[model samples]
Target: MLRADPCATILSPRTSLKEALERLDALMNRLVEADQTGAGIDPLRVAGELGQIRQLLAEAPAVVRAKDGQKHFRCEACGTISHGDRQPERCPTCGGRKFFAADIEQPFVESGAG
Candidate 1:
């Protein structure tokens, strides 16, 4: 069996971790179905595919790095949250930077409006 070309399976722009996992699941189902059908299951091929699927599952998250890398800014003075790259130069709530929490928890979904 010819090994899958790494270049052909690159998941930089077209695929994400979630999608990759879904694809892995689909491949697993196919392998199981093929075995049940007595379709001359090639253990070597099955093993190879399982390995490839595992790799895809492991690599899929790299596509969504930015989504998980978001940081939040919290105004310690008034407990206001700002989901931006950096804390505002001045806190709009208390008009001071004496207390700022850029490491506050960030929700995965983008909060459009306050």
Candidate 2:
């Protein structure tokens, strides 16, 4: 029998942007402290933190767009909708190269009414 990785469960796609940022901040602080004190931080731990930081940075854009209600695009090949100011070079879900605007709403106009 294999056991599930706890870190994977904790740091998932559903992890909020604020939480990710907080984690990144904590990691940076740890690195700074280690650097200043000349402490021997575990090489594996540093490597893991670096990987996590990279992952968080990569996902930050999409998270910000989702929270800000920015425009979204749909992948033509896989129909995956991604939120951003512009279409991603490749679809995050399916790695599709083609995309089009997903949400194109006309501005609401009010008629003169008493």
lDDT of 1 by residue, 1-114 (tens): 454332234344355444555555666676676679775556765566567666665543221223656555655555455566666777776676754454524336453877
Query: Among these predicted structures, which one has the highest lDDT?
Result: 2
For model 1, the local distance difference test gives 0.54
lDDT of 2 by residue, 60-87 (tens): 4431134466888867665567877777
Candidate 2 weakest lDDT stretch, 10 residues: 1-10
Query: Which residue pairs collide, candidate 2?
Result: none
lDDT of 2: 0.63
Residue 48 of model 2, lDDT score:
69
Model 2: residues >4 Å from true position, as ranges? 1-10, 60-114
Top-TM-score structure, candidate number: 2
